[model samples]
Every structure is written in structure tokens, then in C-alpha cells.
Target: MYTSFFLLSSRWSLPMMMSISHRGTGVAMSLGVSLFGLSALVLPGHFADYLDLIRSLSLGPVLIYSAKFALAFPLSFHTWNGIRHLAWDMGKGFKIPQVYQSGVLVLVLTVLSSVGIAAM
Candidate 1:
């Protein structure tokens, strides 16, 4: 029996994936920035104090890496997505093929940017 659910589809269509990534990154970036600002304002002591607190934990390598990823991912995604949006604003990449290509470009740029930020 043929049905809508039986149809094969591009499971990872470029536009679909990019749209979700855009929202995810936007929310993540907002939360990250807000939390960072809040921590600076609400923490009992200065930035060094928070650093000492984290340092005291003696976190394992995995934990450190996860923290780095969490911090880097949103910033990278938002930056890339913002660029994509700017292109749209300039009346570029409106076609489906160009949109998909640009999405790939955005992902690549985001990964590179994130890696660079994490390495810093």
C-alpha cells in the first residue's frame, strides 16, 4: 500500500538540515551568551574565582572536551548562519541549488571556525 510514509526522501536534505541547525544554533548561542553574562554578574567572586572553581574539579579530558564543544558549537553555528542570512539579504543564493550549496559552505565554515575557536 503506497502511502506518504512509504516514499523515499532525502533524509538529510541540505535546506532541512540547515534550517534546524540555524534554530538550534540561535537558541544555543542566546543561552550561552546570557548564561555567561549572568555568571559574571551573579557569581560570588570575579572571573578568576570561577576559573579556580572549575580548576578545582580536576575534570577528565572528556569533560573538558565536551565543555569546549558546547562553548564553541553555538558561536560557530551562529556566525555561519548569520553570514548565510546576509547573503540572502543581498539577494543571493535564493535558488534551491544555490541554497543547498551555501548550506554546505556554511557547515564547512562553521566547523573550521569552531575548531579554530576551540584551539584557542
Candidate 2:
């Protein structure tokens, strides 16, 4: 059963994959925000001090850009996918073709918005 499930997952349709990804990204974003909040409450110094500490590290451009993209991609993906889920709640976009189209659209928008925001 496990093997069959794995095989099916490996060949998952677009909607299936997107649904899984949406849940995964939601969990990731929740964890990220929770950790940030916890750190804010527990850490000694102010947020500015941490910002200064990061700046003091003198991270390279590539590393900085990668970090920004990392932060941006999940946010973008989650937000767009959320709108898709909302449409589902409204009894819309249930058709197979519409599902695939919206899934592709979400991916495109996610990449575009993530890159745009990360570039800022």
C-alpha cells in the first residue's frame, strides 16, 4: 500500500500536486511566522539590533539574494494558492481544465511576484 501510494504520488496530477504543495507551504509559513514571533518575545535585543547584526555579517550578494528569494517564494506561493482555495470554497474552479489552468496560473504568478518582491 505504501509503495503504491508513493508511486501514485510520483505521478500525481497537477491539482493533486498543487493541493499538497499548498498545505506544505501553509505549514512552512505558519512555522516561520511562529518562530519569528517567538524569537521576538524571547530574544534580548531589539529588532534593529538583530538587523544590525545581520548587516554586520557582511554576507555576499548571492547569499543575500538567495535569502530574499527563499523568504519571498513561499509567501507568494501560499498567498496565490490561498486565493485558489477560496475559489474552491465558493464552488468554483472545480472542472478539471479549470483546475489545471488555475494551478499553472498560480505557479506563474508565484514566480513573478516572488522575484519582483525579492528584487526589491
Candidate 3:
């Protein structure tokens, strides 16, 4: 008699991937905010000093826009996922299909919101 206990490793399904991404992004965004808060408290200079420093760099518009997008992307993803969590907390959208659908929707919303914020 032969016995096999090994299980084949396979790629994760969409829902699993989404769930992991959501958690990862949430942790990253929380850390980002915490770091910002800590820096604000520890830094001696005022906010205007930093603002002026950046302004004086003379970087082109494309670089400025890219930086804006980088900053906004995490914020938008966190906001969208937070909404998803809120919906679940209210006992809504618990279905698997809804979860997957909302995952995709959140991503789209994140991209749109990030773009809009970066544009400003």
C-alpha cells in the first residue's frame, strides 16, 4: 500500500489574493500614517520649511505629478478597503460573489481617486 500526504501547491484564487492584498495594503498604509505622525512630532522645523525646500528643488512637472500619484495611491486604496470593511460590519455584502465584485470595484475606485487627487 502506498500513502501520500503531500498536497500540491497552486496559485491562490482571486478572493484569496484580494484578501491578502487588502491586509497588506492596510498594514502598509497604517505604517505610513504612523511614520508621518512621528516625523511631524520629532522634526524641529515647521511645515513651511519642508514645503519651501521641495518648492525650491525646481523639479519638472512630471516628477511632481508622479510624486503626487505615489502619495495618493496608498491613501485611495486604504479608503476604498475601509469602505468594504464598513459594509461587512453592517452585515452587508457577505456573499462570496459580492466580495469578489467589490474587490474589483475597490481597485477601480482606488485608481480613479488616486488620479483625481494627483491631478490636484
On lDDT, the candidate that comes out on top is 2
Candidate 3 lDDT score relative to the true structure: 0.86
Query: In candidate 3, which residue pairs get closer than 3 Å at backbone N, Cα or C atoms, i.e. clash?
Result: none
Instruction: Please give the lDDT score at residue 21 for candidate 2.
Output: 88
Which residue pairs come into collision in candidate 2?
Answer: none
**Which structure is stronger by lDDT: 1 or 2?**
2
Cα distance off (Å), candidate 2, residue 74: 0.9
Residue 96 in model 1: shift from native, Å?
1.5
In candidate 2, what are the lDDT values of residues 36-110, reduced to their tens digit? Answer: 999999999899999999999999988998899999999999899999999999999999899999999999999
Local accuracy of candidate 1 as per-residue lDDT tens digits, 61-114: 778877787788777887888889999999998998899888888888888877
Ranking by TM-score: 2, 3, 1
Per-candidate TM-score against the hidden true structure: 0.77, 0.87, 0.78
Q: How many residue pairs clash in each candidate at the backbone level?
A: 0, 0, 0
TM-score of 2: 0.87
Indicate the residue-level lDDT of 44 in model 3: 93
